[model samples]
Target: MNITFFIKEFHLRHPVIKEIKSALIKRGVNLDFVVLKETILDLQSLGHLKFASNSDLVVFKTTKYFAEHLAILMEDEGLRVINGSKSIRLNRDKILNNITLRKSGIKTPKTITFHSSEIKKISQKMFPMVIKPVVGGRARDVKLVSNKSELEKNEKNDDIVIGQKYIENDGLDRKLYVVDDKVFGIFKPSVLTPSDNSNAFKEFKVEEDLKEIALKCGEITNSKIYGVDVVLGEDGPYVIETNDFPGFRGIKNAGKIIADFLYFKKNEKR
Candidate 1:
């Protein structure tokens, strides 16, 4: 079977790109790289191409807006898209996903989603608040707001916002990759402080109970390839967020596991 991999740009040097290519090759499955930069100006355009192109499966190391758009387009084409558009959209938006999880009886932080005008009301509810973009990703604009003044300052920016009471915990954030209802790997996100601007997160061994949360989250998102980030709170484990396409780092046998899944699925059709 032919699997098409989507990327922002085509490069032989990137480790993730190379890893996907090499792993697929070893299993004797046909792989092709589709670079968004070469063919389209934006995600919408790139998405159109994926719908037109032929492939048995499409996989991504991480989720992006364009990747999400592509999934929707593929759905229109009647192609079976992995991590379909709806799932990606939910996972990328902290406010929406948090609301959904809470409604579903899943544990999430107490959140208040609102327009910028609602900051005054939000400030009244709690202090030592955390503020982040409702739709932002890669933790690009995550911030901690200590009080009303800080929240008001951020309000000037007219973007959808998710405000929540910051849970002060010493526990590290965990990353869990669930493939087809099974825990493929677990990782601990590298520590970050206010002073550190670096986006890198580290991986560690899977916690005993964390796997259960990950699997439950996977079922909630309804995506085959998804990642869940959770933190240990005073009450118990609380899910911070869910990712549609989780990045694989420092996970043993990740590439092989993913490649094997593809290999087996391809042969099963024939």
Candidate 2:
């Protein structure tokens, strides 16, 4: 079987990808990589894109806009893409993700989204909120504001922002990485706190409830491979975010699990 990975150059150096590549090679699966940043797409005609038509599956690993458009084109042409183009686009927006999760009867933090210009009108009662960009990752531009003054002082250049009620937690992040039917949990330091690499990324057994939430996320997004960021608040578990093709940083044997899932999926119909 032939498989193509649509990813950025930096992904080639990722440990999970490296292991997956090695395992798949040993399995004699033909592999191809297309660096999203460097690959050019001819929009004039779908017939010009021979690679899309030739591959059995495309593992979309990047979130670039151009890559998304290309994935859509491939899907339209009857090619299969993991975490499909619609899923990629939905997971990229924090507002939509939150709403979708809530509407689907999943628990999430109470969030209010608004334009940066309307920041001044925000009530002081909404203090002690976690604010972040509508489209962001890796905790970049994420802020914890305790008061209106702090909120006003936050970086305001973003076109949109989401303010979520801060859930009281033990300061450790509970990250659930999902690969097909399996869900792996890890305890890591909160990005808001100082990094402690020594104590980070220790894998642990996931509770059934958390597992259900993780799998439900996959169903909601129509994604086979994804990650859910949940915080164990004083009340209960609340999903903070979901990511498509997340870097499976802490899961044990993640590469083997993911590769096996892909191989099984490739041959499931046959």
Best by TM-score: 2
lDDT of 1 by residue, 82-143 (tens): 67777877787777689778877788777877677776766465777667787765566767
Off by over 4 Å in 1: 10-14, 38-53, 60-62, 184-203, 268-270
Every candidate's CA RMSD: 4.0, 2.1
Cα misplacement distance, residue 199 of candidate 1 (Å): 17
Worst 10 residues of 1 by lDDT: 190-199
> What's the count of clashing pairs in each model shown?
3, 0
TM-score computed on alpha carbons, candidate 2: 0.93
Candidate 2 lDDT? 0.83
Which residue pairs clash within candidate 2?
A: none
